[model samples]
Target: PLKVFNSEQIRNIGVGGHSGSGKTSLMETMLFAMGETTRIGATEQGNTISDYNEDEIERQVSINTSILHGEWKHTKLNMIDTPGFSDFYGDVVSGMRAADFMMIVVSAADGVQVGTERVRQMADRYHLPRFYVINKLDRENVDFDKVYHELRERFGKKLAIAQFPAESGPNFTTVIDVIKQKAYKYAHDKSGKVTEEAIPGNLQSQVNKIRNELVETVAESDDTLLETYFEAGELTEAQLLDGFKSAINRQMIVPVVGVSATANVGVHSLMDFIVEYMPDPTRRPAIEQDGATRKPSDSDPLSALVFKTVSEAHVGELSLVKVFSGILKTGDEVYNPGSSKSERIGQIFLLNGKNKKNIDQLHAGDIGALVKLKSTHTGNTLCQKGKEFELPPIEFPEPLISVAVVAKAKGDEDKIGAGLHTLHEEDPTFLVRYDGELKQTIASGQGELHLD
Candidate 1:
C-alpha cells in the first residue's frame, strides 16, 4: 500500500443520491473491485464497511457521512458516502464541502427525483465537478435511454453519455463506452470480469452519433483542439482524451455512465473513467478565506479544515480533516481559529469507514483523522500558529421537530444532560435547549430519527 499520495494522485468524491438509489452498493462494488475488501458486503446484511454504525445497521440507511478510501490503479480515492434523506442533509452538506467532485447516483427505474435535484443543487453551490451514474440497470423495465435524455433535459445539454447499457433488464450485461468505442460484456459469475468486443452492428450508428457529440464537447474546451477539429474535421484519441480531462475539470462537460452495482457490471469501467477524467485535488479551485487563497501544494503553509467530529467508544473524539495546503504530521502543534485555542495533534489515521490505519504524515489534498484535540469542533481551521485562516462552515438546516426529554429514573437528569451535550458535539444539526417556561429539556432536529 502507498503510505502517502501527492496532490495529483488523490481523488475525493462525494457519493450522494436519494434513499434506495444504490449509492452504498456502488461504493461497496468500487471497494471490492479495488481489492480493499475480500468480499462485497450487502447493506441489508449489515456487513458493509461504510454502514457499520449500529444506528445505520438498524435503520438500514446511512446516518452519518462515512469516510471510505481505496487505491485504484495506484491513485487513492477518498470517497465520502452521505445520507440521502432530507433529515440527514447536514451530513450531505459536510460531504460536499469535503469532496473535490461529486458522483450523483440516480436510479434508472426511478429516474430523476426530489433528492436527486437537492444533491445536484448542493454540488452546484460548491461549484464542484459533477458526474452521473445511472445505477440498477439490471432491474426489470429499466430504461437507460430515457434516463439519459431526462438527465440532459433536467440538468443541461452539457450532460453527455460516457457509457450506455447495450441491453436492459436481466439481459443487461454489456456496456458500450462512447469514449473508447468498445463494448465490454460482464462474466456470468459476477466477478467483474469483462470481455472486450466490437460495437454491435445495430448499435454502431447510435454509437457513432454520440461519439461525435463527445468529440465536439471535448474539442470545444481547448482552442487548439477546436481549431484542429474545424480544419481536420476530427480529433485523434490522444487529443480527445487530453481535452476531455481539461473539459471535465473546467465543468464544461458532465459525463454520465451506466452501472448495475449489484450485478457488478460496468463498475470497473466506471472506476477507470473516474481515474481517467476526474480532476485531481490540485486541479480543483483553491481554499479561500477573506480573499486569501491557499492552492493545494506541499510548499505552502500548513492549513487544514476539520469537517467532522466523531466520538467512539474508546478512542474519544476524532476530528476528520482535509488538508487544503502544506502538510500535517503527527505531533504537530496547530491553532484552531474557530475555537480560538491551540492543540497538539496526536496520531493521524487514514479513514476506511469505521476503521483507521495509522500514517506518519498527510500531505496537501489528502483527508485523514486526528485524535483527541483540545477544543476544535467541526468546521474549524487548523494551521500553523501564525498563519491562520478558516474555511466556510457547513450550512446545516434548522431543526423542524422538537421533543421534550424526561428522565425515567430520578437523579439521572445530569446523565441525560451530559449525553445530550455529547450528542450535540458529535452532530451539529441536533439542537438541545432547556425550556424554562415549559420546565422541560427540549431536543430538536431536522426530523424524528435525528432526535432518536
Candidate 2:
C-alpha cells in the first residue's frame, strides 16, 4: 500500500530564476523523475507545466505561475514553478508568498543576472529561506570556481555550497555532496537516474575543506553543539544532520546545490536536500498580529490566506491559497474579512497545471484551490465563522507595459469586459481599465509581451 502524508507538513518548494535559465525545464525533469508525468515537457516544445499559457507556447517561455505536485521518496513535494521574465512578475510574487521555501535557479555560464538579483530581493523582502541551484553545468565554457567565487562576492558569504560540481562543463559527470562526503554520478541522458560513487581522487582535498566548513557552520547553531565541537574537533554524521536541519529552519544557512536539470544530473540529490533540509509548514513560525495569529494547527481558528486567483474555461473562478491555520473543507462556511462577508468553501482541489485532484480538507502548509468562492478575491482572508483574521496580502510588481484591447467581434463589448474582469480576478497584476480619454479598454501588465 502507498503511504500518505498529511498536507499540513508537506513542503511548498518554489522554483524561481531568470528566463531561459531552465526553471521550467528543472520542474519538468523533477515531475518526470517522480512519475508525476509519463514524459517530460521540454521548453523548446512549449509543453512544460509552468509554460502552459497559449502565448508561452508560441514564445517558448512561461507567462504565469504553474503548480505541480509529486511524491519524492514518501515526502509530498508541492512545487510551484514560476515564470522567469519580469513581464510576469506577479506570478513570481504570488509564488513566493505561497511557498515556505524558495529554490532560486541560476545559470552556471551566466553567473548572476538581473532576474536573479530581482528574485533575491523579493525573497529578502519576505525573509524567505532560499536555496540556490547553479544550473546547466554540463555546458562548455562554464568556469565553476569563477562562477562560485563571483556568486559569493555578489550574494555574500552567507551563501555556501552544500553540493559542489565535481567537474564542470562538457566533462561534468558528478557532484561532490559537501555534507555527505560522497560523489553522485548521473546518466548520459537528460532524464536518467543517479548512481552513488566515491569522491573523485583529485577533488578530495577541496571536498574535505568544504565539508569541514559545513560542519563548523552547523555546529554554531547551539551552545551544546559548539562545546562538543571544540572538545571532539568534528561532529558526527547524525549530529551534523540534526544541526543542519536546525540551521536551515532558523534561516542561518542558505545551502547551494548544483544541477544540470536538462541532463537530470543532481536533480534527485536536490530533491533529497529539499525534503531533508527545507522547513515544512509545521516548522514555520506563525505570523502574529494584534487581533489574529496563524499557526500550523488544525485546531486553531481557521484562517487561510488567498495568494493567487485564476480564471478557467469551465471552472469559472479559482482561488489559490495557503492555509496557515486550521482546516478548510468543502461545504464549510468561512468569513471573508476582505469583503466583510461569509463565503462557502465550494470544491477544494490540488492543482497541477490545468489538471486538479479533488480533496476534502486543505491543511496548513499545503497549497490548494477553492472553486467559485463568492466575495473572496486574491489577497483576502478566510477564517472560521465569527473569527476574523487577515493575513498580509502579497505584494505585486507595478505594470510597466500597457495596451488597448478592443473586442474584435461586434456586439460583444460586455462579454469582453466580463472576460477581462475574470482574467484580472485570476491575476491581480493584470489591470483592466477604461481609458475615458482614449475611449478604449486599456490593459496593463509588466511588459508588452505580458499584455498579449
Candidate 3:
C-alpha cells in the first residue's frame, strides 16, 4: 500500500495448514517481523489482525479468509490467511485461486494431519507451487528431524532441507539456513530481532549433507546445470539460487523450513526465502478461461477476478479482487460476466484484516478491494467494459451436512432469508433451500461447526 508496485515486485501468497498449526499466528508473526505491526497477537487472546471477526474471536479459530499485506526486502507480499477447519475449506479453495505460491504450514508437535493432506490436494488441483513450513519448533517432545522425515515419507523424496533447527523445544532460538550456510538466532524476548552467527560445529556434518542434497536437486532440474555440476563437481552459491528457484517453480523439489511462530523464531528468514525462491505471478502460466488467455502483465487488457465479498459495517459491500492483467483504476466501468452488467469501479483499497488503506489503483498480480460495486458478487469476473470474457469461477466442494432453520420470531423470515442469501454468495459451499415436504428451510454445509 505504500506505492503502486508492478507485477514483478509483488507476491500473492496463500498461507494454509492443519487446524491449530499456528497458521494465523505465523501470518501475524510475519507482519510483526516486517514492521507491519508492533507485536504478535495470540489467537486465544483474540487480538490477531487476521482473526478480527467477532465469531473468530469467540471461537479462537480463523473462520474467514483475511487478506493481509506486508513489505519485506522492497517487495510487497499480499498474504491470504485462510481458515484451517475442514468445514471452512471453501475459503481455502477460494484463497488458493488468488495465490501465486502456497505456504503449507505443518506443526512439529502434531506432524502432518488430515487437514494438511486435504489442503495439499487442493493446491495440487490448482497446480500451485508450494513449500512446507514446519512450525511450533519450541514445543516440548517435537523433533525437527523426525517431523521433517515424516514430511519426506508422506510427500515423497523431493523434500529438500532449506533450514533446520539448531535445537528444538524450550531452547529453540537458532536455525541454520543450509543454502546461506549461516545461523539466525532470535531474541528470547519474542521481538523477532535476529543476529547472524556462524553455524555450530556440532551440526556441520548434517548441514553439509543437506546443502549437498539441495545443490544436487537444483542441478538436476535443468540439463545445463546438471552438465556443469558433473564437470565442476559443484554449483556456485549464485548458481544454486538460480537453479533452486527454477526447480521449485517446476515442482521438481519442494523446500522445507523450520520455524516457531509463537516465539517469532525463523519467521523472518522464511519471508526472505519466499522473496528469493518462490515464483512470481508473471513466471507462472497465463490464466486461460473460455479459450482466451491473459498473461500477468501491466500492458494486457483490464481483467480481474472477484474472489470474495464482505458486507462491512458502515462501508457497504466490498469486493476482493486479484488483477490478472492491466491496472484496475478508480472510476473505470468494468463488465461483470456473471451478472451481465457493467459495474462502475469507484474507490479502491488494500485490506489488512478489517483495516482498509485507500489506494488509487492496483497493478497486475496485485490483490485489493473495490467499494460498493453494484451487480458484482463473489466469483464474478470484472474486465474492460467492451471485453466480454470471464475468468473461471472458483470451484468449491459440495456441502456435507444440512439442518433446518426457523425464524426465532414471526415476520423475521424476510431478514433471515436475505442474510442466508448473502452468506451463500460469500460462501458457495454453504447451500440453502426450502424443503416443501418438511415445510422448513434447510441450510447445509460441511459439518456441525459450520452450521453452528
Candidate 4:
C-alpha cells in the first residue's frame, strides 16, 4: 500500500518452519484472505506469491525469503516468508531480526521437524514472542492432536490449542476457534470464503476443555486475573481477552492454530486472531547501541538496518531495510555506521515478491527496499549524521560443507571470482576463500544444494 502507517498500526511477522510444512501456501492463503490477491495460489503450480523465482519454482522449494505485505482490519502486516531448508538458514536469521514476532508453521502430518526445532531456538535466542500454526490439515494421515501434543512436549505445557480441525483429510472444511467458540466452514474453491456456524454437538466438550486451558494459561501470569477467576469460577469474555493478550506478550501462553492452506480453511480466523491478540511493533523494545536507544517512533532520530540485498532484473541491487526509529524520506543523506561512509537516500518501495509499489517515505517499524546504495551492504545501519546507533548485525551460522572450485574455462578466472562475491553478498552463509596451501579457491555452505 502507498499509504503510510504508524508503528502502532503495524505488525512485522516472520513466517518459518520445516521445508514441506506448507509455509508458502500459508502465505498465499493469507494474502488472498486479506483481499490482497484475487485467489489462492498453490506451490506445485509455481504461481504462488512467495515462491516467484525461477530457481524456486523449478525445484518446487523456497530458496530465499520473500518480503510481502497485506492490510488486515486496517493494520499493516509486513510478513517475511523465510526458506525452511538449512542450506539457506541465513535468511531465517535475517527474518527473525526484522520481525516484531515470529509465526512458526508446522505440518499437521509431519509433526515436529529439525527445522522446526531450529527456528524455535532462534526465536528464544532473540526473545521474540511466537505461536505455532499446524498447517496441511487436509493432507492424509494428519492428526491435529498428535501434532499438538508433540509441540507441547517439545515446546512447553503452556502451549494452548487456539483452533483445531473438526475433521481432517480431504474433507477438512471446518475448523473450530477456541477463543471465538465458533466454527468456520470454508469453501473448497480456493476463494477463502467462509460461513460461521455454532460449535458442533460432538466437539463441544473438547472445545470447552481447550478454552478452559487457555483461560488457565493466561490467569497464571497475573495475580489479579487469577483472583478474579477463583472468585467468579469463570472469567468474562473481556477479562479473558485482555488476559490472553497479556500472557502472550509475556510468553506465558504459546497458542497453536490449525489450518489447511490448500483448502483455504481457518486462514482468515488466523489473521483475525493476530489482529486481536498479537502485540504491535510499538510493543517491541528499541535496539540499543552506541549508548543510544532507537525506539520505533517517528519522532526519534532516524535509524534503519539493511538486513538483506537482492539484484532484480531492472532494479539492480535492492537493500531490504527495517526502520527501527524515525521516518525515512527519499532524497535524504544518511550515514552508514558499519561502513563509516555517507550514503545518499534514493527512492523507497514496498515489495510483494517480484512486484514493487513505489513510495516516497517509510514510517518507523515498517520494512521497505532502498534502491542502489553505494556503500551500504547487508548488516549495515543507516542513521542521521552524528546521532549514530549501530544496529546489531544478523549472526549468520557457520558453513557446514566445503568444496574446491575452479574456472571451467582458462579465461574465466576473473569472472568466476566476481560472480562468487555477488552470490556471497546475497547470502552470507555461503563463504569463499583462496586456500594458499592447495592454491585453489574453496567455496562452502550449509550443504550440497546450497553450493550447487
**Top model number, TM-score:** 3
Per-residue CA lDDT of model 1 for 313-427, tens digit only, reads 8999898999989999988899888888999989999888888899988989899999989889988889888887777777877889999999999999999999999888878
Give the 10-residue window scoring lowest on summed lDDT in candidate 1. Answer: 1-10
Segments of candidate 1 deviating more than 4 angstroms: 221-225
Summing lDDT over every window of 10 consecutive residues in candidate 2, give the lowest-scoring window.
1-10
TM-score of 3: 0.98
- Residues 397-442 of candidate 2 have per-residue lDDT tens digits of 7888888988889989999998888778778889999989999999
Clashing pairs in 2: 309-426, 310-426
Task: Return the lDDT, model 1, position 137.
Answer: 98
Model 3 / residue 393 / CA error / Å: 1.4
Residue 76 alpha-carbon offset, candidate 4, angstroms:
1.3
Cα lDDT tens digits for candidate 3, 184-206: 99999898889999999998998
